[model samples]
Target: MLAQVRSIGSRNACLAAGELPGGPWAARGGRTYRTGASGSTSEAITRARAIRSVTSVRGYQEVGRADLFIQVIPFASPEDARGGLTELRGLPRTMPQSKGLSDVGELRTVAPPTIAGTTHVEAAEQAFLLDGEHSRTLTVWCVAGQTVVVAALGGRSEAIRWPQLAEIVEAQVAALG
Candidate 1:
């Protein structure tokens, strides 16, 4: 899926898994980046593979008191992303977490269509809050044909910076059109 999204070359991008300061993500694949020690780079990348027709770039680092993993996965089309989202929606209920954290709130629903051939679905769950500090996740699906863009953002509350996250998503819709 990550490879497929990279192949499709849509403008949407996702944040890497790790610690991040509160702010707009850098301009890498329209995504913010960070990493963590316990993060599963392989699992995230594996999930990324499920989407078709995408490309992926993974970056790992240790910044602050945590490990940083950043992946920039782009999709071929909005339809593909939507399809990917559909697949990811199932993860929240089935996938396991690191432990100690609790599910805060989750918003899962199929977004409106994008372009003539693409669709979008969004599912976000506040998987955990570290030491009662900060942790949130927002996953989006951009689908077009067999391609998909699955953007997963996870980190300490301070690290998941992307105030314009919603704007980036809206831009994705416009690009899909």
Candidate 2:
């Protein structure tokens, strides 16, 4: 998946967990790992296989810089996708509590501006100080046919502007094709 992501553009991007070729950010080692039931312990794996349709889970991080994580879960039907979207809509309300965060600045739903004409339920959290540095995260949940895509991007406040991040998501959607 990281390879597919890196092939989308000319930018000098590489798999987060692979060897670092000499470059500006070479000294900062990056890593990626799978999460959720798909990669968890044996009991969780059994439960995931029994009841969940999650196909993949991957997380990418550029050391101290930025991060992108994606999970692909395929539903049985469009109706299931709709239900999933409704569940995702509650993210804004539950996120702060889940993270043990008290200073949630703004949490609201936003229309995802996509070039591919795929409708998505998007939510963004306003930049907030984390460990004394400003940071923000955006999550976009889209149903492409019967597959529900959950993509999240997090970055240092200065590293990525909104437009750039949107473009990255758009490219990722295109790559999914």
Candidate 3:
């Protein structure tokens, strides 16, 4: 289970495993779409999965590949978006085979391969690329109040998926509160 740090009074304390965020929220931004408590952790995971939906757009192709790929937005709060990417930088140590980070952002090695990057709202871009693998997966963690998107492309020729993911990423950011 993921550990959490908290403050009992004025002193900071580290809670044991299985501890909740504390009270209603140890961390909260604008309210999440989640309502009501889930019965179990499995249920929570299911809920999280359900909230994240996939929409197809041009540029991504799955014409022919043994392993199919999918893109996912891990979190969607402004702080979570920015902080998450910032936190991801440390993933290289925990997750080897990062292929050395790129000018875009940090990436973690996963099944079917993966690409990750960040786009300054001002600059407006999602830097991405497929690894040597035949199939590639990408996940964009955007700042809260912004859209988070990623794309899975079939092969090297599928580089076109970047532009399509970029468009949706922009729209999602626009939709954010």
Please say which candidate is ahead in lDDT: 2 or 3. 2
lDDT of 1 by residue, 1-177 (tens): 335344455432433332233332343333232211224344443444444323443333233322222233333344434543444455444333556666555554534323333444343534466557567655545554444444445566665533433344444333433
Off by over 4 Å in 1: 1-84, 92-119, 144-146, 156-163, 167-177
lDDT of 3 by residue, 14-107 (tens): 1211232111212111112221122223432333334442222223222342112222233324344354345432333221245732334334
Ranking by TM-score: 2, 1, 3
Each model's TM-score, in the order given? Answer: 0.41, 0.58, 0.31
**What is the C-alpha lDDT profile of model 2 across 31-91, one tens digit per residue?**
2222233243433333323443445555566667766665554444555555565555554
Q: Which residues of candidate 2, in runs, are more than 4 Å off?
A: 1-52, 91-102, 115-117
> How far does residue 22 in candidate 1 sit from its true spot (Å)?
8.7
lDDT of 2: 0.50
**Model 3 scores what on Cα lDDT?**
0.30
Q: Hey, what RMSD does candidate 2 come out at?
A: 8.4
Superior by TM-score: candidate 2 or candidate 3: 2
